[model samples]
Target: MRVTITLLAAIFFTAVSYAQVAHNNLFTVGIGAGLIGGLYDGNYPYSSLKQHGNFGLGAPDKLDGELVVFQGRIYQTQHSGKTFPVDDRQLTPFAMVNFFKADKKIAINSALNKEGLLHLLDSVLTNVNGMYAIHISGKFNYIKTRAFPPVKAHDHTPLAAMLPLQHFFEFNNVQGDLIGYRLPSFMDNTNISGYHFHFLAAQKDAGGHIIDVKAENITIEIDVLDSYTVHVPPSRDFEQFDFKKNRAEDIKSVERGDKKQ
Candidate 1:
């Protein structure tokens, strides 16, 4: 009958729509700009994140600390530079994840500082506008990292206000992993552009958001993720937060880690 044919057509179209949406390589809960505005209240649990990807990074709810996912385990590096295993019940306000499938792997033994390393990796990417996940493992000549203390988000405390409270740590001749992503320029508001990484020492004792680094004799893995899928947080704070203001400079300043180290 005509009605049966119409129902079948509807189902077919719905299936196609889901297929198109699920194709994006990157899956993120909330946007990066929310952090700039202090929207740090979310209920997205680490268990849910584990289901999405094993290699990614983000922050825990209430700006508790730096959240890093390496290999298949999730670790929370606190402000004191101590790492702890994150429970499945623990939640994150913002995070980026992907089912990583490496497109290429490169070996570099030449001495390179953070800037140099970033430049070298940048040169490897032929498409400047493309998004890619980068994994660097091996010895680090020197590395500096920092983590934010747990700041109450319900009170509307801006991230800038919590800047002075961040704790920094430095290590030399250490073994660790740097997990992160390099996104396109157009995703400024949607997410952070350029390279962003979080460090976790091999001992699983110390790590945080990477501020600077110097490395040699390391294997760098690159996974190209061309598209992204964002899941908006359903929290009341997220729904009410004002996102109209431009926070590009704020984001850049924070990312640059310009403070005396």
Candidate 2:
């Protein structure tokens, strides 16, 4: 009997442990953005703006339309530390594109293995008349910092170092809008939120070099999908309605009878 009881207890503990582990892995989707700031020297034209949207994770693969669209814009200015300015007379025209993958591993591995993708990104930058960089690999967290030119004459090492803590930035005369969100129901329990990615683009010189490098203000957004479990608040113990009266109702009846008497 003692041995049987011990075995049953062990089974119960194992089941409870398994349940806790399962509960901790519930998937969630997160969204965020990054902003850039700076002043334009007379030699260049500059305008500040904000980026926003939802980022995806999991089996069905959610959509981060805003990030996908504005990534290049952010990457060029922030990651490369290059200045993107409009012509003195012309407005700074903006363009955006969206990229998607069925899963994070596939996205990272494909970027690593496929030369075409890299070339495609390069082509996009070449046409932009600005500085830009793209790096997709190893669950989106891996940033190829070496791919772009250094932030001109600026000490951005502090911002770069803080990236692991979250995205960081530096510049003068900066301000803008930034926001983010996470929806758990989108991804079907595949633990997809750990990955990260961004593409940045900004105005540059005829030689595709950034000029008068400076960031005014920056807006940053980050979306983490499948990063961890979400806890559902426990249900409340609401009182049930009864058709039949109990003691409280009975007391009311007695009071009515006393009034009638």
Candidate 3:
């Protein structure tokens, strides 16, 4: 009886371990470097991207506007701070997505800025080397965001050159949700190393890339990813493009809207 019980226990433990490892996965199309280097052509359509995951962020074809996938519905936030539903036929040049299932929840009782918020998350982070999907929703005392305007289709101009033309906005006491990821440093070329968040304002009508924020009395949901896969486009342009150049500074400027150093 003791031997039989031991065998059954081993089987149960093995099953649980396998399930935990396969529970979370991250799917991404195109690399962050491609977005900054002007490989802005559409690689995947919204219809196909939906199959990978339901919650994430990216840019529409031609880098027209900021793309946010929330609750299985896709939205585009234009320079006007107005959000609109995206067509299934619309394509994306760069996107990161995952079927989000919260692994834990943390509630805050004090106001915190972007840096402070990171510190709070880091304090309880399960693994600093693992990727985490974060969802923070509620009223924000203050938040600032930015969005890029549409450019000509297949325009070869690097995204950095357009930062001066990007529009910025600030909101006070805004009700919204922030969808983003906290990636490990090893993922530098594949995605933003730290945090890359997009905001959805109250009623889901306004949003863009979150530049800054202050929050209090809100819940933060975190999902630790177990695996991540990158799908590099199979295009002649991508084939000949150089991925070796250290464009880290340029990429940061594109993401933060900072002037090129």
At residue 43, what lDDT does model 2 achieve? Answer: 18
Write the number of the candidate with greater lDDT, choosing between 1 and 3.
3
Steric overlap count per candidate: 0, 33, 0
lDDT by residue (229-261, candidate 3, tens digit) is 888887777887788988788877876778847
For model 2, how does the per-residue alpha-carbon lDDT over 144-211 read when each residue is reduced to its tens digit?
21112223322223222322322232322222211112222232122111112332332221111111
> Once superposed on the true structure, which residue ranges of model 3 sit more than 4 Å away at CA?
1-23
- Please rank every candidate by lDDT, starting with the best: 3, 1, 2
Question: Model-by-model lDDT, in order?
Answer: 0.84, 0.24, 0.85
By summed lDDT, the worst window of 10 consecutive residues in model 3 runs over 17-26
Using Cα atoms with residue i matched to residue i, what is each candidate's TM-score against the true structure?
A: 0.89, 0.18, 0.89
RMSD of every candidate to native, in Å, equals: 4.0, 25.1, 4.4
